[model samples]
Target: MAESDSDSGNLAQVRHVVLVLSGKGGVGKSTMTTELALALRHAGKKVGILDVDLCGPSIPRMLSVGRPEVHQCDGGWVPIYTDSEQTLALMSIGFMLENPDDAVVWRGPKKTALIGQFVTDVAWGELDVLLVDTPPGTSDEHLAVVEKLKKKHHVDGAVLITTPQAVSTGDVRREITFCKKTGIRILGIVENMSGFVCPHCSECSNIFSQGGGEELAKLTASPFLGRVPLDPQLATSLEQGQDFVRLFPHSATYSSITTITQTLLRSLEAA
Candidate 1:
């Protein structure tokens, strides 16, 4: 039997936890998570992206879901399933608050409890992969999720996301260090917004210094997942609450994300 199975019960019974993280914000990490989930679904994987960024949750908007009805189930709250019927469970603090704009002012313990409920109390059923989209910076929420999963639940690995910029790259290094301290495996690094592809000319321009993510991966000894260029069509779709993978499948942006998905599957197989 595999060591993972020997330690984690039946291999088939354990869910693959792929934590999608970024050292800072505005690097398109959440958007990458959304597209990755869609690409995995396209490739026939029962996947779900858990939006844990309480202060600024984007999964609902990415999936075009409005305020979903949440109620007690058995012992806890039930996650809202997307319209695709693929059972993509969503648990975010945005759903529980009385007002969406209200601030989530809590200390470490409260944040930890909320994260615990999100993981244990919610009915995720069975998932092939749970892509956890964490918030920017090493906050209480981020620490809570990593600690809970590492000490309690079975976390398969983590995928770091960053832009091809010096600041983001620097931040990713810290994220890798944090993972090292927590014993969570660093699966790979995704270089998002590596460049901007000009559709009319089919040319790619380095909007941000390119290859920073790959360099970080090399420095940290993690796999370089792939790079996603900045595509305006993607931005437009996102503004209108549409996902590029599902809405613009034939676009260049979608192709970039598809490549990332392929690389991700290969990493999982290698693991």
Candidate 2:
């Protein structure tokens, strides 16, 4: 479902929308979403994150802004802004929970309705790009979001995340099939946790089997974006909700993220 043009086929107001998905968990999918948003913001593009991982929304915590006030206006529900410049905005069901430890115990129909509202009812204002982060597997929420994105938004494509391991890529393969079936264009594959970078001496170590994500991309005929190495500093920044690329411009992980984001931008412009 490659967009014929950005203008004609896009959603009412957004310039582009990218869904960040990984078939399996623990592959740094959420972290990748956070990094890409920061990178896009750094490039001066207006961006927002719609954390559709309903049961476990981490965008607020990862952004370190906490649950913000959702103001009602003449148009609709206004999303929470994370920065002073207001270039970044966020909307998530997690913000609606009464307690952090409480679970999102809802049935299929309810989940779908909430997701639809997040897409159509929320006052996203104007956005250059809206990155949606989903839960690990392709389930009810994935289908609901895909349906809404098809009917309501002009999606740029999907950014699939995976680690360098057969087990992880195997699950991500199913995610690719899900995208194909749903008419969601696949932008590329991001190989996260490709390798480990030693903090003390900056030495590289292949703690996990390498190149599975690249191999998967090759097999699926998708563009191989780039790989993000495992770094302690990057993890700490994610935990602290600090901008890793902003604070660690010279680090390896930052370099990979910047390159991958550049690739996505180029792909979008060409499309």
Candidate 3:
């Protein structure tokens, strides 16, 4: 386990709890969560990320965050903050495993219990928003996060991520219904990896077949945030442990997702 720290404050100070979701795995939901968090922080908002993915926590790696110490504060267990001008307060089950390769082989009830602990135990301090990166589908992890966050604080809404393919979008559409049934607002739907660009010619290609996301949004009557092209720069930035928006401010992927994140902020404010 990582080191622990202490702080003071309840989760009520957090204005919005944003849940990031996907229909299935490999849709880049975690990447979206990390980038969106950084974008919001770069805009001067206090942000925190709770990686409830548990079995497949990836926020720490994408953000280049090392094992953080968990501390106790007046309110509860304090999470570790990133070492940056706009530090991102983060908490993840990954920090608790004895080794990075350790597998979390727990069942549903146990997963639920751990999620409850994350919601009530960690000291998030006062945050404008807390972004939750959930595992794929509306499974146990998703249910636990929504149930616990709402029980402990106001969950603003959900942002569903999907690739530009039926296989991906098909699953993500169900998340919208899940939000509706649970009374969680549908902030919007994001079409990620909609296309790819040839590094040599600067031309974009639809390798995975595009437009399924936009079509699904229309069919479901949900807000289509925008489509993020598969820019080579994005992967490189992530590999280099750099913020995509900060490093590739003018890329299509940056422009597309930033707009969506801004729209999300507006929705949170209105909530």
Candidate 4:
């Protein structure tokens, strides 16, 4: 086993483990993970994010903590805190790299080993939820995460991200199949970039074909969380590593995200 199956006590303090997954890249899995964690924190829940996208560890930059040193204690490596209250925490391979621009060009086995170490090594302490941001596609990294997390800490479920397009929804179907084959429950499906929200007038325009994600969810018998429109202000905030959820409470994007978060919470509660 990549991780010691007997070492299940490491994540005993973690109450829920949820994975943010996508079949294709640039579908906003990382962005969803960041925004959801922030919303959960705003709702008074202690949240942690484990960025397992070793090839592209953008969560560290997204959270605005750039390449901070990771310390270790008797339990395991200490996760970097993102806020003064310490309600939000993050751990990613980006902190270990000498340079942020460097690419992680390791083999499949190496990636799997690093993921295994991350699963059992992070001292998350007492967290209400831990959201895992996975890489695009169903590859060795995904298998490693499922194996390690299932053998040790329980995986509550997975939240699939997809764009409002046929191509994107088609790829997400594969992700749904992957979850089914691995026995990971599908919490819900989120439609991202479903429309473009004008910053000035606050009107939404469908730049891409809409309703694909919701239609797919209905077809697959999965829960349709909500749709997040593409807001320029939200994009700018993400680029600057600012908290858009707090800064832009009146934005449509914020409303959508909050709705999604509430629905997801309800699902978890009902489970």
Candidate 5:
């Protein structure tokens, strides 16, 4: 027999709430968040992806959800899922706007209100994990979510992403500081764009000056999750709204990402 409808409509009991963030832009934080969600789902866990990058949302494009069908029920709003059918409860402003390019211009208070609705009003349904894809930088939106989540719920932990660069690592350090002040525990660090692998020679090259994130994790005493090498195919796959984890499970980059997912699961399980 099929499961009950109520079982698929609420996520308050989700075991883990993971915030995927980066210190800077262009570090593939969004991509990492999506892939990690897909990875967890592939591992037999129900997951949700919340793109809180209000001003520059990307989950819709990455997941090919396009504009979602919004509806009002009771006193709150309900978020729509994607056509990919990953069983993910996806929420993003892109789903509400007539066009994905519409701008979200609001101050801190207003932003906070919108996020409140994003959290309280939307029907998240059931989930094993809720992956929040925050915007780059430590902006008002980022702070609001952190503050709100901390006040409202016991967040499982954070999965910080960073590329292999000094500037990127520096920003990530500040993120660590913020997390410290907010009492959020660091789950681990995933070093994205760690290097590039040559198809011809099967050799790895330090395209973004490797190991910056690993070095920072060492400095901060956080676990170095794993390294995701740069893959040209991944860019194309993400653009086409495909789950790289499912589509390229045997690829080197996907294997590394899977390792990071395992680290996360292990920590959660032990906790």
Candidate 6:
């Protein structure tokens, strides 16, 4: 049997894999990953999140699964189920860390090895989607993940995240190039924190420049997913590990995310 065939045993039950990527940090990349996973869960899909941001694994805190012990079974490592129904599961380097505050100071090869293990070892059983939350920039970790997933399992595509600033969108251009070079399909570009919506009058103010993400998508001929405005309620829900999508159904942020999720689901179905 081929190596890919042998390695396929781990992720054989997973239907689709999506990578959530961004060009720079502090742009809510991991937050987008968590929100997307939750949105998918609300859509009644079994979802798994592989947090590959070794140096800064914040998914655990974001999901409120703090420092849960990871165990290994006969198949492989068992991922932590975030919900009672077990529809949402997650595996992250944060759980393995002795101290969450300690910085992960490691070279490229070690990170690559860990990413490879994450790609092949976690027992993500029968998932409709597995979202790989990556660190910022097109670096060794990105390459390691893309190579392992493409060689062993199928990576459906990547959802690129960006802020509305030129600096952030400029970095995303490099990410677009990186995806093209690696032959990973660009599912769409999401403009996160596009603007801030007032809670009182509900007026949207562009504190940051807007439409850079859409402009980039048009320039590259990639699908423009949607813009997620900056909403305090959304941030509070994420910080408190609450289901914002379900709780704040009438909020603009919830609508934007739901629409984006629908667009992503449609794209996946069409594919």
> Which candidate should be chosen as best, given lDDT against the real structure?
4
Tell me which residue pairs clash in candidate 4: none
- What's the C-alpha lDDT at position 110 in model 2? 98
Q: What is the Cα-based TM-score of model 1?
A: 0.90
Q: lDDT per residue, candidate 6, 1-271, as tens digits? A: 1245456877888888899999999999998999999999999999999999998898898899999899998878999999999999999999998888989999999999999999888988889999999999999999999989887787889999999999999999999999999988899999999999898877889998899999999999999999999998888888887888878888888889999998999898888
* Prediction 6 TM-score vs. true: 0.97
All candidates: CA RMSD (Å): 2.9, 2.7, 4.5, 2.3, 4.3, 1.7
TM-score of each: 0.90, 0.95, 0.93, 0.97, 0.91, 0.97
* lDDT value, candidate 6, whole model: 0.91
lDDT of 2 by residue, 114-144 (tens): 9888877777777888999999999999998
Cα RMSD, model 1: 2.9
lDDT of 1 by residue, 1-271 (tens): 1234334322233367788888999998888888888788778777766788877887787777778778887746767777557556677777777877789887778878888767656656667788898998777888888766654456778889999888999999999988888787888899998888786885779966899999989987898988888888787777776757877777777887898889888877677
- lDDT per residue for candidate 4 within 1-271, as digits (tens), equals 1234346766878878899999999998999999999999998999999999999998888889988899999989999999988999999999999988999999999999999989889988889889999999999999999999988877889999999999999999999999999999999999999999988898999999799999999999999999999989988888899999999998889999999999888887777
Which 10 residues in a row give candidate 1 its minimum summed lDDT? 5-14
Encode model 5's per-residue lDDT on 1-271: one tens digit a residue. Answer: 0223333234345567789888888999999988888888889888888788888898888988778588887635766665456477688888878866678878889888888677666776567888989988888888888766655455777889998889999999998987888788899998898888776675779866988999999999998999998887788889999878888777898888888888899998877
Ten-residue segment with the worst summed lDDT in candidate 2? 1-10
Candidate 1, 224: how far from true, in Å?
0.3
The positional error of residue 102 in candidate 2, measured at the CA in angstroms, is 0.9
Give the Cα error of residue 10 in candidate 5, in Å: 6.1
Would you list the clashing residue pairs of candidate 3? 3-69, 3-70, 4-70, 4-71, 5-70, 5-71, 5-72, 6-72, 7-73, 77-123
Instruction: Give the candidate order by descending lDDT.
Output: 4, 6, 2, 3, 5, 1
